[model samples]
Target: MKPTGTLPLRAGLGLKPEHYQNALDAAEKAAGGGLWFEVHPENYMIDGGPRLAWLDAIAERYPLSLHGVGLSLGGPEKPDEAHLARLKKLVDRYNPASVSEHVAWSRLGSTYFADLLPPPPTRQTLQTLGDHIARTQDYLGRQILVENPALYLSLQGDISMVQLYVEAAQMAGAGLLFDLNNIYVCAHNVGGSTQDWLEAVPADQVGEIHLAGYTAQDREGDEVLIDSHGAPISGAVWALYESFITDAGPKPTLIERDENIPPFDELMKEAGQANTIMDSVARDRQYG
Candidate 1:
């Protein structure tokens, strides 16, 4: 039972508990509110709670995208069946517009790192990831998007990351949630051109896009970019996004701010900026 279909790519926000009602109200008012939201499924994996109730209320009106932080799909072994079961339950209950997880794995042995960690691009790892994605899609009875993770260090691997992602997408019948910021961060940390990576990845497989802020730090007299998701989307990443969207066409873009969240109005302002860019590009295409 593959997911019935993907939600239309439109501007959206990450549904935060503190701003749930605000989102609902904005939706009701038909204000500058975004058309949908992406949430970390792990947050709502609970048996029951007011959180679920709030999500239900807003979801009834606006579309939803379930973004999972765990699952460890890139692990050396199969994905966590229990986690997949919980995700499937969420999909069943909410009938969300889309579901996605990161390309990085988080668990090893019995311990969880609580962060999206990287894996080498080895043939073994690619096969393992492809299998995991296939199993996840089968269990959920729907398609899912695998988001690219920000790289922090260089590792010797079996295959190119783009090839691994493409193969995984093909085998799993999954989509790609192309995160512009992640690519920029990875390119900054490692030595690769963001444009080249963009061209290598299968654009048609990208069903959604994510934009977020990052932090710049220096280590060993070298610069490193961290996917903090804490600040505003940077100009360089915005340029990259513009180039990609110009030809890839607009996909549902999200403004992600997980930490140091400013007021709702401030975030909305950022979303508005993205929406404006998308609209301008779309209008140009229609008229030109």
Candidate 2:
């Protein structure tokens, strides 16, 4: 993808309190030309608190990525107005270099599920998602990126993944936050090739790349990969990521670990692996 205005960011970590000081220290240290941090805006969706304080501190030193997990842009209903306003406040205060949300819908009627749920890819769903994204952008007064959700079950859907996502990006004037781990998980679960998905997606619309861990479950003796960002990235996923880096070129790659919280040093190490790979890819691109 050809990054238009913003200069591409390198590797970064999803911010956790355990690693906040480490992120601040890394921002100051510039070890390997520094690292960036992405955060779940929902965690900081408070009126006033230490979370904002920490965000301000780290954001001052490094480029921050505000990735939202709960926008529910693909719901059968319109996007929540209050949520949009709160998200806009965060965007205005931080002026984050990048902002993103998932493609999955989480809320049905008034009930909200904490986890992202799959949406049937119909034309109606795409229209709703596009409108929600556009409204979010209008409220935030800027462009946003839409992340591909990890799949669990194979559902009968009308539109293809790439087609719906590409159309949504185009209609909403948004970018794609490509998650390699999710692509692998979905492909493995739903019986498709990751390469085909990548090739079909409009590469220029991709703004960020995510690398996370997945768990393999033997569901009735059939292996299914779950997008559990709890542990270190797997070898196969990393190999696929490397292949994408070589072909698609580099973007702002992020190491995501949302569960099984670990020590600061360990999390930093996970982020460091992604950093090393992105840097190597950049150098290869430059020299080759």
Candidate 3:
């Protein structure tokens, strides 16, 4: 299936309860045409409530994207049909510009973990994930993007994560949601060349980009980077984002801050910075 709709190649923020009114007001004022908002469908998988009501109002004025965190697409079994049905309801109601999910599993035999647990990137796991993605798309009747997860420990996979993601997209007819912060954290923890990994990603397969913050701590005298998304975007992550846009051109980028919630203006400041970098890339491509 062809791409349904493309997100404006600009900056967006994850919708938070604290910023609901701010988002609604910005949308009403038409503050920025490229400014968009993303929400986890898992949060809105309900029949009716204030949250859904607020989402209904915000989505009317801004292009929305659904970034799912609980599908557990890479689990041992196929995606849950009941979960898919609920997700489908939200998709049909919202008609979001894009939909995406992580490349990790959080469910195991009816037990659901709060965290997105990384799956071993082995050939067998790849096949399982690809099949699950294919089934998910078939059920939703829309193409979805698969995001790379943060890696803290090495798994028994001969192939690199970039190759696994690219192959999964090809096998399932999906796109990639490249998260620069995750790449940085994973590289710091796993001991690899981040630049080499970035270069290995298929440019055409990337449909969206994610930028977030991470925390570093010393563990047993070894520094480990955590993909916390609870702070501002770090300078190094911003630099990597610029490098990615320089190579891949501009894709829909999002600033995700899930903790330590800040004022709406602060989030907008980060989004504005992303827009600036993307605008610069566009200018260079146009004139150079």
Top lDDT: which candidate number? 3
Which window of 10 residues has the lowest lDDT sum in candidate 3?
1-10
Name the best candidate (by TM-score).
3
Superposition error at 17 for model 2 (Å): 1.3
Q: Which ten residues in a row have the lowest lDDT in candidate 2?
A: 1-10
TM-score for predicted model 3 compared with the true structure:
0.97
lDDT of each: 0.84, 0.82, 0.89
Report lDDT (Cα) of residue 96, candidate 3.
94
Per-candidate TM-scores read: 0.96, 0.93, 0.97
Better of 2 and 3 by TM-score: 3
lDDT ranking from best candidate downward: 3, 1, 2
Query: Rank by TM-score, descending?
Result: 3, 1, 2
lDDT of 3 by residue, 24-49 (tens): 88877878678889999999998998
Which stretches of model 3 miss by more than 4 angstroms? 2-5
Better of 1 and 3 by TM-score: 3
